[model samples]
Structure formats: C-alpha cells, structure tokens
Target: MSHTSTMISEDIEAYLKEHEQKDLLRFITCGSVDDGKSTLIGRLLHDSKMIYEDQLAAITQASKTSGTTGDAVDLALLVDGLQSEREQGITIDVAYRFFSTDKRKFIIADTPGHEQYTRNMATGASTASLAVLLIDARYGVQTQTRRHSFIADLLGIQHLVVAINKMDLVDYSQERYDEIVAEYQVIADKLGARDIRFVPLSALKGDNVVNRSEAMDWYEGPAMLELLETVEITHDQNRRDLRLPVQYVNRPNLDFRGYCGTLAAGVMSPGQRVRALPSGKVSTVARLVTWDGDLEVAYPGQAITVTLEDEIDISRGDWLVAEDDEVPLANGFEADIVWMHETALEPDKLYDLKLATRDVAGKVKAIDYQVDVNTLEQRHADHLDLNAIARCQLELTAPVPVDDYRTSPGTGSFIIIDRLTNITVGAGMIHRPLDSELPYEFREHDSKANVVWNRASVTQAMREHLKGHSGKCVWFTGLSGSGKSSLANALEVELNRRGYHTMLLDGDNIRHGLCKDLGMGEADRAENIRRVGEVARLFAEAGIIVITAFISPFRADRDAARELFNDGDFIEVHVDTPLDICEQRDPKGLYHKAREGKIRDFTGINSPYEVPKAAEVTVNTEFMNQQEVINLLLKAL
Candidate 1:
C-alpha cells in the first residue's frame, strides 16, 4: 500500500510532488552471524504495514519449509530472497529494501554478518548515514560486532543504534538489555561513535521494532522507527566546501554547453566563482539547469547541469570547486585499506586505483601496519591477506585533487582494481598526503641533521606586486641543436624589453659555472638537470620570469622540474625541429664528433632524448623565425 494512496487516486501529480519532497535516509543493519539483521528488517516492514499482501502471503508460504521458527510466520524470509540464503538461514550478500512511513522514506541495507563477508558489509555501509548494529541479547557482544562497528566508524557513520535483539529469549529482562548496552558502550566509546541510541527488540516476535512492545514496559524509549525518522542528518553533509566532479559535458547545440554532475557538497548559485582543477581556470556560475527548469539555488545531492560564464576547457573526470577552496593535489598519500581479494596485496605491483570518476595506475608503496579488528591493535605486516585491514602508503602515476575521508567521504574514498582481471580487489579511505619525491638518503639526512628552513618576511605576493608581474617558468626542452637555446635567449630579451624581471639559465653557461663538475654520463646529466631546475625555481620564486634552455632528455627528470611549480606556472616549450635539422645545425661540431665516437653519450647521437609529451607550446624552428618563436612563447605566457 502506498503511503498516500488516497492522494494518489485524487491527485496523482500532487502525490508525486509530496513524495519527492520527503527526505531519504539510508541505513544498514549488521552484526555477528545469525544476529537477526534480516529478521529485524522484515519485522520493521511488516509491523509498519510497508509490505504488500502478495509479498506477505509469499513469505508466509516460504515459512513452511525454510522458516527457523516452529509453526509461526517467518518474517526473515521477506529479505532473505535468495535460495541459498533461505536454505542456510543466513544472509551471504548485501540485500537492500525500500519502504516509507508518513514521516520519512528509508532504504535499508541488510548486510551479511559472517566474518567472511565483512567486505560486503563495508560496501553497504559506505554511503549510509546511520548504522543499526544488531547484537543478540544472549551473546552480548562478539568479535564481528567490534569489527563492523570499527568499520562503520571508519567509514564515517556518525549515527548508531545498538539494537539488542532476541529479548524474548531473555524473558524481556531489562537487566540483560542493560548489560549488553553497557558492554557495547565500551566499544562505542573506543570508536568514538556519536548519537548512539539503544533499542531492545525481539525480531521474531516483533517487539519494539515498529510498535512499542507492551511486554517491555520498563523500556521508556521510542521504537526503532521513531528514532530513525527523527535523527538529525541534515547537518551531516559537507555544506562548506563546494565540489562538482564533472561527469559529462552536455553540449546539445552550438549555443548550449553545460557541465553536468551532482553536487558532491556545499551550495551553488548564479555568479558564484568556481575553479576547474588540473587547469586552474576560474569562471562564474552562469546558471544552474535541471531537467525541470533553471534553479535559483542548488544544494548537495542535486543532479544539475551548470553553465559557466567563460568558455574554458573542462572535461569528464575534472573537478569544479570553489575558487578559494584548499583542495590538495597529491600523487601519493596514506590510506586505510580493506583488502577484499584472495590474492595478497603486492607492494610493487601496479593496480588501477579509482577515486570518484578519475582512474589511474598506482602501487601500494608500503604497509604501515595491519589492524587486528578484534583488539584494535596495530601490527606490522608486509602484505595484506583476505579481509585484512591495514594502513598503507600509495603512489600514483599523476597528481589529482584529494580530500580526507573523515571529512569528505565522497571525494576521499577509492577502490583498487586488479590490472589483468579488472576485478575490484580493495577499498581505501585516504588519511593524508605524503611527501612524494623525497629520496631515502635525503629523508635520513633530514631526520638526523639539525638544519632548519628559514622563512623570509617578504612574501611571494609582495615580490610579484613589486615586480609588476607574476613569476613564471618558461622551460624549453629538445635536442641539443634544436634551437632551444636560441628560443630561450630571444624570449628572455623580448620579456626584458617589455620591462619584466627576467633570468635566463642556459645549458652551456650553467655547465661552465654551476654544474662544471658534472660529466656527460646519464647519472651526471640527470643531476645536472636537477641542479638547473632548482635554480630556475628559486629565481621564479623571487618574482622573476625564469627561462631555461636545456636538452633535459628524460621525461621523469622533466616531470620532477614541473612538480616544483604550481599548475599553469611551468610552461614547457618543445622546439620540434627534426633531428636531421638539429644535427645539420650543430654549431659546436659535437654531433660530428659523436658520429666519429669522439663525444660519447651525446643526445640524439648515442643517448636518447625523450620528447615532451604535453608541452604548452610546440614550435618548429626550421619553419618559424626567432621573432615568431618569441612572440608565440610570450602569447602563451
């Protein structure tokens, strides 16, 4: 029966509008094995008149063969729909059911209670606002109870209801219910669970599930349904930080281009300034469009299409956030992982890590410790086994925006997929970002040495204001004779003429002074590039437009240089003159000597030069003149 069956017959549209206005609460029921989680849900549905007659009759018939209760209707058969579940009288997989009362609608996840399916329970609890932790009155509290409680707390389920079921077995004993509540409260205190409420019920006999049980008159609290309907979950959402991860670009015609996604947090309105991540483009929200019409304001969880005032580059998997929000962009972080695969976690193996809509390859760099769910003890382990929970450090191929899982679960949680099989093998909650590129020797020195970094009283903003321009890094990378040096020098001269504070770091000039001791071998060349990159970064920090011309061959070394600056500050200009042109223009005769094996490991001759994959500007010096190249670099800048 519908909650508004009379209104549905009288005014169908009005009924729908009323139904849509009602808030939804998602909760999960979980505990130890055979703790009557399914039974409790079935009782809630039956006693509240949420179940239909046909479904009730079907379960009444199923009660004859598979019912655990003797000669009584088996309500547990309502949610235990699987044949294996009915036969074994246990929930193996997560089962969801939807029902509503006059006050609020609910979607309940009846998660499995067995130790083997703890991962299933975690999956169900990931999005729930409340958790109904069922404990058998006879057993008090079990190991699985603590494990589930800890996981629920870790997943940020702040509301908890410790439902002590099978109270009739204890003859409605208030002492037993009190004892169980006292025992579970200790664990709850350890977990720091908030808004905990205790309810005594007999799932089989329907005591205090929906209707207050007359047998337990000593209990003065409201029923389970009452507490669920009135719990304050409105403030649970993160309403301060605005995030909308772009899921699709809705471009129906030339005039229409709207970024479509659900608001993950906070509120949005017209004229609100937002920034596109990974690009750092800022634009104001022009309009908020939904399927029905344009909205005046949008809140979290509303699926809407947003139009920006400026035409900037935004694509799927990019994030739109408030311009001032301090979202972290990290390539490595520490996370708590729940390993779900049978194969143990291998630290060196690469796996597909997915957070929100963004997917990238990453590795579990190290396991900090494995948590014993029973005792909440941290034990050191190299790898994680099946259903093992541990804190591990992860390294990703590229940096993406991240948040702490405790404060923002929507953007902070991630999953690990097997590389070959593509099966989701583990789930993780991010703790914090780790320093990504620190070498072991440097880390040891930092720990042992007493060197401290001194802070300058003058800020970078003040320096930029004094210089009348923002600092930048124009990095030119290509073959030795590919006109990189010529382009860098010309661009620096043009910028200097324009009254911009500029510093030019040329490859040959640096070798004569700063890197005179470095050789031409691979390791020495890498160290040489690292030194130049650091000097360029320092110059850029001093509010100077730093220009660099180097045959930085390795992509990894170049990426390290790029990481030293903020996004959009590092501009890589690839001088794409062909290798033949570069060799022909070899003014120093180095290419000719390398052809005769005089200069060994020379770039583009014996050594390799990895071309820039995503350069901001690519100019062919063979076709374009020095003035044209300088103009192009200035335009990009």
Candidate 2:
C-alpha cells in the first residue's frame, strides 16, 4: 500500500471507532450494605485512566488516613461524594458516574445498600436499563441483595450482571463461585430475570473488572466493561406509539407557532397525521421545528417544537399522538406505588398527583396489598409505611390520559405530592385507569359520613306526613343545550304551586358559586355532580322536593349519587333531547362557542354524555310542550 493511502486508512479507522463508542448505556450498582458497590465503580474509573493525577493523589492520601481498603487506595471515596457517606464509610444516596471507553460510553449509578435508603436505590434503578447486582462471595446472597434484585425486577430492568465480588477472600476458588451462582439462580428464577450473566471478581484487588483475572484462569468470560459496551438497549423503549406531551407553547413571534416538548415515545415526521388527546382534534404535522432549524423527522427523547397544519385547542399537558391507536382517557387510575415518605399513606386524604407535565389533585382510595421483597409475597397492608411497595387505587379530580405502565412508562408513572406541603410522598406506576368501579367507593363513603339518622322531634316521616308528600330528588340529566335547566326550573315552579315545598339547582347557577373552581373537563364535571348530589340529598331529607340539573356524564358517578339516597327517593329524569335540536336551540349560545373551539369538554360536542340507562321519567322537549314534560315529571313523583 502507498504511504499516503495507509494514513488515510488509519483516519477512517479512528472515525469508525469513535462512532462505535458513541452508543451509551445506563446501569446501576446495587446490593446489601458494605457490598463494595462504590468500590467496584471506583476501580472501573481508576483502571480506565479516567481519574486525574491530582484526584488519585487525594484518594491515595485519604486511604492512608482512613484505610477502609487496608493498604490499597480507598476507591469508594471516588464515588462517595457526600460528607456523611465518607464519615460512615457507606453509600447513603444514589451517586451517578459518567465514564467512557474505546468501545462505549456509560452512565452508572452507585445506589446505597442500606435498608433505609432502599427507596433511593429504586429511584435510581427506575431509569436504568441494566443492573449490576453485587454478591459477596464470602457471605453468599444476603437479604439486601434479594431486596435490590426484587426492586430491579419491579422497575422493569431486563438485564442483570451478577458480579461475585471479593473472590480473593475465598482464595479465588471456582467452587465457591459456582455455589454462590447456584443460590442466586433460584432468586433470579423467581424474579423472572432470564437475561442474567455471572462474573466473579474482586473490586478491591481489581480482578476481572476491566482486565482478565490471573487468579481464576479456569473461568473465561468478558470483563464487566465489555458486557456493558455490547448490551443491546436501543430497542428497549416504546417506539411504536407516538406520545409528545406539550410542555410549552413556543411562540417566538406571530409568524412562528410551535408546541415544545421531548418526544416521550415513537417518531414523528412532517405531514404525519396526529391527534390531540382529550380534545381528540386531528391535524397534520406542518413542521418539526428545532433549535438547529426545521427538520424532516424527530424521534423519541429528542426535544423539539412541533407545528400543526390546522390550529386547534392545545395546551401544556395535552398529548400529540399518532392518529391510529386507542389509549385510555380518564381522570382516575389504579397504580402501584413505592412510598418514600416517613409518614404512612392515608386512604381518603387528598394529594397532589403530578403525572408527567400535568398536576392535579387525587387521593389514594385503598391499599390492595404490599409485596414482601424477601419472599415476594403479597401481604395485606392497611397503610404503606416508608419504602413499602403496594398497589393502590387513586382518584383524580380531573380526567387524565395515562397509558399502561407496561406499554408506555413515560406517560404512566407519576409522583404523589402532599397537597398542602408540596413534598413528594411516593412514586406511582399506573396499571390502568378506574373509569367506573373505583372512585365510586371514595365518594360513597365521603357522602355517607356527612349524614347520620339521629333522634329528633322533626323526624323525616313526620315532616313528610305534615307536607302530605315524601321528599324527592328529581335528577334532570341530559346533554348541554338540551333545555334541562329550563325544564327543571319550570317543574320546580309547578311543584311549589301544588303546595309542595321545592327548590331547583341549576348547573350554570351552581357553577357560579359552589362549582366555580371546577373545570368543564370530564373529571371536574363528575366532581361537580358529586358535590351537587350531596347537597340535593340534604334537601331531600327535609321533606322538601329537590331537583338537580347537570350533564353528569358517567353512569358510575350518577350511581354513586343515588347510593347516598334511599330506594325510590332519587328520581332520574332523562331529558331525551336530540343533539340536532339542542344544537339548533343553543339557548345559552354554548353550541356556537363549541363549534368555534372556544369551549372545551362541552357535552355532546367534545365530551360525551352517557344517557341514563334506567330513568323514572323520560321527556322529549322538542316533541312535547313544557306542560306535557311537567305533567310527566309530576305523574312520576
């Protein structure tokens, strides 16, 4: 070969090598207390020539003063950045280290092994693709080792490198390595961690970590660094479904309008069809805007601004998704949580749930069960103490779009914050949303607690006998612009003239004061009905005829309202007004606002109105006159 050609070949080889090393891996080191997690990381950094000369000198000097590693350098000092950690000779928090080799770049988290800091380890492991579980060859597998392994399994870590460290303590015997591996295999089988690789090395002596171990020649496997560099993680993410949550609306000028957020999943290209969640508005992607100028395409994890071809109602927390999938849209969810607080989680106490970019109020409805890390047993737990992992049902005050955690964790996981204190209490993984069964239990008990039959002169039956009629809660439910409020007020006027004490609770009038803060979103609207349902129940107990007008969207919420009343006392009055008639009438001009996109979650427009399954009286305002509807309600009463 020519001399000039040889130089050019070398340059191409260097570029290829650099490109190969750009693949990044994120892994975590976790085990029992004093398992040398920090030491193993320190040895990797030191052997890879990553440690500076001055930094090495400081660690070498600290080793002489506080020789945790005996005559050698205290490598743990390299990762133990906290003063408390150095003083206690233990890792108390999750410490992250960034390093690179000729083959790959790596980000390793050194997690604490102490039981008290187990939650911290989970936080670090939550985002890791692989786990380096350390097992002491001398002690075999300990309890904290099982704890770490169980947590890694729960967090969905698919790859595990079981490093049998401190092999020098056992004279580097292959027999001891085999025995420890056999013990861990049983636990690994239980965790269903099939992709487990075993390696025996001494982090203190720097054996089989970055270099082949001369002490154990019988066993041959790639060193820890090689496995980390070669492990396939590019395909681990959910790349099929597109989820771009709008974090901010980027408007640099009148000419430019873009939605800014990191793509949580899948890919997006210009002109691709996309749908906005909750609003369900479909539009074509106009541009993939970035700081580097407009791009033709964008993939998951890339932060970019997206522009749509048509203008629509979109705000922060709304998701832009591929227009070809059915995802759950709701305000409540059943979730698995890891409690990280000192105080126990209460069932009914309201909490601030922060799911991705959205913040809303919710409450833990119930603790189904807690898992035992040692045995992997599901034990009954009334309340979750610190570091307790359990499945709990949560009820949010508004509807949210949450994908299943197994499918899309980025949009499924959330943090529970104390409403008043604003401190994060726990981390939650959404299993699914509670569209019906759950949350009913929450409202059922809440309304029941406020009422109790007591001895009194003015008894319910006595008041009914004197008034010559039983109290009734006539629930007027239908779509907005369906003349529900007008019909309810007219019926109330007729009931009063018939010598029956009556009152009407209009939906709009109630929103002005009682439900003013509630949004028109599905969840908020359900909550509005719940609040009004309770007040209507109070009026019914006074032997006075009570009537309510609301678009109460869900059958489950309406059922919960009825659960608070006695049988036959609560009357469901369905206003059977067709959508076309209501839209034409548009008494309050709501349908016009809905068509203009000025009103969101307007029933029969954007949000749905689940018609009553069984109503005591059904009246059609378009086909019948006002007196005919009033006569039907009176006959039913």
Candidate 3:
C-alpha cells in the first residue's frame, strides 16, 4: 500500500484510541463569496502536509485546464465536486473534510456562500464548536457577511475568527484592514460574539494562511494555522447538562439489549444514574461498550452502546437525560425559522417536524414576525417565502422533548417537512415553549350528573327523509375565479328550494371570520380547508347539506381533509376551468391584479396550483353556465 493509505489506516486506529480517551472537536467555516474560506482550509491541510501525492497530481492536472495564475490550482474545487457547482464556480452544499495536525484533529464543515444556500450553512454550523467567518478585504462586510455572522452566533458558536482575506488586492495595507475590522466589530458587538479574532491574510498568495506572512510586517498576530493548532475548543461544549437522545434501541440478541447512540452532551460513567424523559424512569448505567471493548466512562464525542442495570421499555425518540437537569416538555413552541423551500410557509397548516431523532406532526399556529437579515430587525409578515427568516409559533399534535437552543443546541433544533411531498421545507431553532414557566399538572375532574337536554333522539334515516335528501358536504374546488363560488351558491339555493336544509360556506366568507387570522401560504391554505371541512361536518350532523366553495389546490391536503369525514359524506366537485378561461373571465379583477403584481402569493401567479387527480364531479365552466355547473354538482350529491 502507498504511504498515505497506510497512514490513513494508522490514523483510523489512532482515532479509535483517541475516541476511547474521549477527545474530539468539531468546527465549521462560514462566509460569503470570494471570502478565501476554501483556500484557507486548503492551506491548513497543505501546510500540514496532509495531501497525498495522487491528490496533489489531480489538482495540478486540473489547474492546467485553466489559465496559469499565481495560485492556479483552484483549491475550492478540492471540496466542491458537484457538476453544476463546478460550472458555476460556487459551493452549493455543505462539504465535510477531515484533517489533523500534531496538536488536535478536526472535522471541518465547509458551507456554501450564496444567500439561497443559507439553510446549508445552518446545517454545517448546527453542531460546530467554533465558526470561522471569512471576509474579503475589498468588500469588508456585506449583507451576507453580516447575515452569516449572525447565524453563527444564533447557533451558539461562541468562538469566531474574522479572517480578512485577499490582502494582496488591498496592498496588505494595515489601514484598510483596520477599517474593515472596525466595521465587523459593530456586528460582533450586536451578535454577542465572545471570542472574536481578526486575522489579515491573502489565501491565494499563500500569505499568513498557513504560515506567518513576511509581507505583513505591520500586522502582529499569530498565523491562521498557528491559531487553529493552539485554540482551546473544549470549553465551548455544554458539559453541564448530560443529554443523550436515544436514536435506536439495540435488541440484536435475545440475551442482551441496550440503548445505542452518540453522546450529544456531557458525560456519563458506569454506575451513574440516568433518567428516561417523559416516563421519568431512573436506571443505573451498567456498562458502556463500543465495537472494540467495554469502557469505564464515556463523554461527548464518543459513540457507544449503553446498557442499563434493569430492563426497561425504552425505545427510540426518547431522551436519556441527567436526573438533576431540567428536561423540556411542551405541545406548543415558538421558534425562529429559516425557510428553504420554494413553497411559502403558511400559518394553520400541519407539517411533519423532525428534531434530532424524533418526529412529530405539528401545525403553524401563528407567525410572530420575520427578521430582515440585512437589518437584523423583526418585521411583520403574513407569510414567509423561500430564504426568509421568520419567527413562528407551532402546535405539535403531541408534546416533544426539547430545550432552549441557547442552552442546548442538539435538542433545541428541528426541521419542518411538507406532509405531501415529504420534503424538508425549513430549519428551526426553538427559542422557548409557549408555557415554559407553568409547572405541568395532570388532574381528573369529577363527572357531572347525567342529563339529556334534547327532547328527540334523531335517527340518520329520519333526518335525511325530513330534509328530502341525504345530508353531505359538496366540496367545490378549482383554480381561483373558476366559478367554484358561483356554482356552490347556486347549488345551495336549489337545494334549499328543494326542501333540503342547506348552508353555503364560501372560502372568502369563512376567511373573514373562522380563518380570518390565517394567511394565504401553502400551510395556511391547507389549514383553512381543514377548518372549513370540520364546520361542514358539524352542519352535516345537523341534517343540513353544506356546500363549500374553496380553491383547495393540493390533492394531498384535500385527501387529508376528506379522511376526516365519513364515507359518502364528503363529495368533491371539481370545476375544470382552463387557466386561460379563468384569466379571461377575471370576474373579481384578481387575474388583472395578479398580472400587475399588486399582491404576492396569488395562486397560479407567484405560487403553484395543484390539480385534483380524482373528483366526484368535474364541471367545465367553459362548456356550461353556473346553473349547469350547479346541476352537475347536485347530480353527484
């Protein structure tokens, strides 16, 4: 085997030994475009002589394809490997690279710089102990520069390095470097960055990146490499609270069973008592074992299988926490979110939330505010679009174990998933549970004396016969201005005239009252339909046929609402109007307004409108009038 391959194998053995000794540190590099982040890391690895001969040959060969410059090898290409990313000459995803010096080994997460990739940067900085924010000397501190710094601070990265790169462009001038340093100092103060270090260097020219720059005689600071080698990162971790979220329950053999997961925070030893959260079951640690052998104790950064003294019904998604430390439990929480999906976040829609290893169904209950990343100020917004950072309130179907992100990074973060597409839409940091202070109390109330208020015990058959028809909900759905409201209104009138007690629920009318507080985002729209469906069910229970007119676009959301109703009770009537016909009609002048961009998030304009796959009745508004569409809906009913 080659020397480098042999060294890598030896390093793996040493890594296992060091892990058993419980010593590891993780850091992330975050900055904007042309910040020299990739080069700085490349310099660190190169100066340490960690690059293999084959890798060096590849980089040299790749460098020949482009024009020869002072530092021709595009070091950024070493980490960014995607075809599109290479073509655009930009980093798009979080690329992780591992390297080590004599002093300390490091796992570095190199994040992208584009504003659109802010979510990727968050994923990199989520579990990092320190963050390196690179700044170009010419631009000083741009909006993305400030935004990235703020995000690092929000993620609890206490240690920060503001590497002033591209000093060659600025003539290695201390005055220019000092001016940029002053600009970033204001941001550091606002963000509460405790340990801030400013270093001036040119990554391309190999000055002060790996070794001290001879050109920068006026600058008096340790080189970037020297600082990283000696920097103390151990104190940055949360060692006070012992939190180990159980990822999987290992029951491989019938004779043995244990909890298997990485130690997220703090330390635990054999014979130490640990409590299982939610259940409050306490057990003593019997043994901590890895693949190699048993360990007397295990700390954070060590992945081990833990065995308890007694058998317990412990499973995945449960937290194994220190007995003395407080554990978070709440059904409702408020969080700051960085939306990453094209679909806007809607208040009132249920989303699948994934936190750590636990998954829970949650709904966006309220939108507190959105943060303008440039100004770092909260602004009022009805809905959050892609790349928007907003503070929102969420109500989980069941209580989840969580923590304040400022206190514990691991348990305090979550991701929002789209129920239909199963796509991760946003990343969230839990600020606090809605009811953090109130102590949890469970009590049973006494039953009141039995009483029957209603005089008549109404049967379903008798109620249907009295109404002269069966009670059901006629769900009219189509694109906006597709005659859904007109058809539903006409149908309600006809049903009432036919002696069937009928109620018309227009989407716009319900938005004025029942869903008045909600917005028009994807999540909010789904919630609006959900609430309307429930109200229609109540009307149906009262033996009244309910006609609901809504632009219930997404099939998944419509299906979810339909699932709540009994079979044959919910009838979907699709108004199949072409986009061109709806735009031509423009009955409410909505299409004209959409064309003029008077309002944002108008369906079929700025947002997507999903067509229903199956419907009980499909009425083409082009081929028929409102009366004819109503008749078709009535026939299905």
Candidate 4:
C-alpha cells in the first residue's frame, strides 16, 4: 500500500480506539460568502499540524496562480478542491474533513454559503452537534448569515460559535466586534441557541485563530482552537432516549436472523429488553455483533447487527426502542420543511416521506406558513416554491413512528421523494404529531347490508371484478378543449346506464371544491394529481368505476399518479388532438388566452407537453366524434 493509505488506516484505527473511550464531536461551519469559514477551518488544520508536506506544496503552487498578493496562503484553497468551486471561488457541496487535538477528535462539515445551495447547508447541519457561524467584521451579519443561523437552529443545533471573522480588515477594533456580537445576541436568543460564544479573529491573517494574537490584546476570549478543544460536547447527543431504527434484517442462515442498523440515539446493551414500534413486540437483546466480533454494548453513531432472544418477525423500516418509553406513533404530523429541487411543494398532493429507514406515503394536509429567512417573519402561504421554508401538516396512509426534533433530532427528521422519479425534493423536521392523544383507529367497518353504498366503495368493487380493473384508475389525460372531459363524462354515463356504479371526477370541478385552495405551478400540478389518485382509490374500494379527466401534461407526474393504483387498475387514455385543432375548438377561450400570453404555464403555449409512451388508449379527436371516443373507452371496459 502507499504511504498515505497506510497512514490513513492507522489514523482510522487510532480514531476507533479513542472513540471507544469517549464521545465524538461533530460540528459544522456556516455563513455568508467570503465570511472566512473555509479559511477558519484551514487555519485550524494548519496550526494543528494536520497538513502534510505534499498538501502544503500543492497549496503553495495553487496560491501563486490563484492567491491575492501578501495574503496568508489563500487557506480556502485547501478545502474548495472542485474545479467549478475553484474557478468560481465558492464552496458548493458539503466537504467533510477530519482532524484531532490532544483533548478530542473532531469531524467538521464545511458547508456552502450560496443562497441556492441552502439544501446542502441543511444536509450538513442535520448531523452537526455544534455550529460555528462566521460573520464579517466589516459587513457585520448579512442576510445569508442570519438565514444560515436560523436553519441551524431549526435543525436542533444547540451550541453556536459566533466567530467575528476578518478582524484584520476592520482594524481589530473591539467596538466593531462587540457591535456584531450584540446583533447576533438577539438572533441567538430568538433561535434558542443554548450556548452562544463570541470570539474575534481573522481567518485569513491567522489572528486569534489557533493562537492568541498580539494585535487583539484588548479582546479577552479563548482562541478558536482552544475553544474547540475545550467545548463540552458530551451533552449534545440524545443518549437518554434509546432509538434504534432497523435499516435491514440480516438473515445469513436459516437459524439466525439479526437486526442491523446504526444506533440513532441512546445506548443498547446485551440482555436489555426492547420493544419494536407499531408491532409492539418485546424482546431481549441477545447479542451486539460487529464485523470483527461480539460487543458488550453499543451506543449512538455505532453501526451494529443485533440479535434478539425471541424469533420475532423483524424487518427494515422498523424501530427498536426502550420498553418504558412510549413508542412514537401517529397518522398526522406538523413539520417544518426546506423545499429543495426545482419543483414547488403542492399542498394537495401525496408524496413519499422517508424518515430514517421508514417510508410513509403521505399527503400534504395544509401549508400553515412560510418563513421569510431575511426577516425571520412567517408569511401565510398556499404553496411553497423552490428554496422556500414552510410549516405544514401532513397525513400519512398509515401510522409511522416519529419524535419532535427538539427531543430527538435523528428520529424527528425526514425527506420527501418524488414517487415516480424517486428524486429527493424536500427535507423536513417534525414539530409534533397531530394525533398523539387520540385512540388508535383500526380498519374495521360496519356490515354493508344496512348501509347505502358510497361512490368510493362502488368504484372499488368494479376495480376488483375486472381484476386489473378494480384497484386501478382510468386517467383521461389530454390538452384542454380536446374532448377529454366530454369523453370521460360520456363514459361514466354509459357505465351508470348499464347498471354499473360509476363516478366521473372532473379536474376543474374538484378544484372548485376539494382542491379549491390550490393554484397552478409545477409543484401544485404534481400535487393535484396525487390528491386525485387518493380519491379515486377510495372510490375503487367501494366497487364502482372511477373515471378522471385532467390536463396532466407531464408524463412523469401521470406515472406517479398511476403508481398509487394496483396493476391493470390504472388506465391512461390519451386524447390525441393537434394543437391547431384544440385552438379551433376553443371551447372555453383558453387557447386564445394561452396564445396571447395571458396565462402562464399553459401546457402547449408556455410549457412543453410530454406525450405518453405507453398510453392504454389513444383517441384521435380529429377522426372520431365524442360518441366514438366514448364507445372506444366503453369497449375497452
């Protein structure tokens, strides 16, 4: 092996030995552009003698081409290694760097400062125990600075270090440092930052960075390195509450089945009794096994495979908790979400919400408000756009275990994924479960003989009778004025007349009531289809045929809606009408409005429409009248 690889292996071994003796501290650095976050970390590593000779040589060569004259080695170059980041002089993705002092080993998450990469910052801060927020001594606290601080607080980062960086630029004036510290004091108080410390330093000049600077003799504060080494980080973890979220069940042989996962919180010892959530099965810990051998105990941050004395049916996405502490279970919850990706968050749609290892299919019940990061004010919103932070309520199809972020950060956070594309679109922190106090409702129903059949139940039966038909949804999708809505209405009429219970869910009609509060946006459009899918499922359960007509232009979104149904239950009927023919029809004057730019995000006018590749039925409106389209659909049924 190469010398560097050998050294890295030795370092990892030493780290493992040290970690067994004491707790580990993980922290993150966050602030605005040019706030010296990267410089501060580089200074910490350089002064600690963590930089190798080759690394130093590379930095020196890079400095000659990229560094400002007479500057202290352009320390930010040490961590910003990406080609794009180096050329743009900005941090992008979360860069993880590890180093150790005699007192404690440290893992630092150096996060980006750009406004567009707020999601990256949140991702890094989510696992951080402490947050070091840098502020420019000359510029004071800018909007991005406050915004990063707020996000750190929202993610449950308790300890905060306010580094008044670039002191040399501001002439090392104690008054200027004091002014910035005072401004942050108000913010720290509002964010509930438990332990807030202020220190004056110049990351670029290395003043009060790793050592005390003679230039700032007037300021009496611990040096950055000294503070990091001495800070009490043991209390930053949730060790008191035992939570082990099972990521996988390892069944290597027929006789043995072990639950494998990283300890999210607390400690687990061999022979300790634990309870699995939702299932409520109690078992005693039989053994804690690592790759090397068996361990007597395991704690948070340690990944291990655990065996139970009883042969219970354990699987991934299950949680193991202390028997005395109540297991988290709720069908509805309130969460603070940071919207990521280009798509907006729709209030009326269903999304795949993943918390720890568990995936819960949920719908957005309501969007309470969105926060203005610059002002820290909450503004009521119907939908949240990209890069927005909002408080919202969600209702899941089934109960999932969760804790309030203030109580347990690991068990309280989640991410939302697009069902069809599986792209992570949002991150969320649980504020509270909405139904914690109510009794658990079982899926039991009264006898059907005494009750009047609902539209949902009738549709559900029809879906089952058709086998592939009973649980699937028939989505009538096409351009507006292409006879989509008319064909759906006629199909429902024919089915009802033939003694089959049927319901026609028109997109515009539902929006007039059930989805009345939503609007038109990429995010809203996806969400609208999600809500309609759920309602159609309810109808299908009742043994009736449910037909839906909507101008769902995106193929990915339509597929996402189709996934909610069982096989053969989802039917995509494409009304193939040319744009010119649609305009000629101009049934509602929508085509004229779209042509004149009076409407935004119009499918054929402003936005690109995706044709379905595997549509179940394609009706040519130009060749066939409304009756012919209805007859084609009826024959298929």
Instruction: Tell me the TM-score of each prediction against the true structure.
Output: 0.69, 0.66, 0.65, 0.66
lDDT of each: 0.89, 0.85, 0.81, 0.84
lDDT tens readout by residue for model 1, 1-637: 5354788789989987888889899999999888999989998888888889999899889999999888888888988899999999999889999998887899999999887887889899998999999999999999989989998998899999999999999999999998998898888778756689999999888889888999999999999999999999999999899889888999999999999998888899999999999788999999999989999999988999999999999998889999999887888889999999999999979999998778889999878778898778877677998888999989899998888888778888899999999999999999988754343232223246666455543557657766778899999999978898878888888888889999999999999999999999999999998898889888888999999999899999999899989999999998889999988989899999999999999989899989888999999989999988887877898
Of 3 and 4, the candidate ahead on lDDT is 4
Better candidate number, 1 or 4, judged by lDDT:
1
Candidate 1 deviant stretches above 4 angstroms: 2-5, 436-637
State the number of backbone clashes in model 3: 1
For 368-417, candidate 2 gives per-residue lDDT tens digits of 67888666787666688898899887888888887887677788889999
Q: Give the lDDT of residue 610 in candidate 4.
A: 89
Number of backbone clashes in candidate 1 = 0
Q: Candidate 4's error at 349, in angstroms?
A: 2.3
Question: Can you list the residue pairs that collide in candidate 1?
Answer: none
Top model by TM-score, which number?
1
As for candidate 3, its clashing pairs are 346-524
lDDT of 1: 0.89
State how far residue 39 of model 2 sits from its true place (Å): 0.7
Q: After superposition, how far is residue 504 of candidate 3 from its true place, in Å?
A: 30
Q: lDDT tens digits, residues 406-475, model 4?
A: 8887889899999989999999999999777543333444555544433221223334554333434679
Q: Which stretches of candidate 4 lie over 4 Å from their true place?
A: 1-23, 69-72, 437-637
Give model 1 RMSD, 1 decimal: 20.6
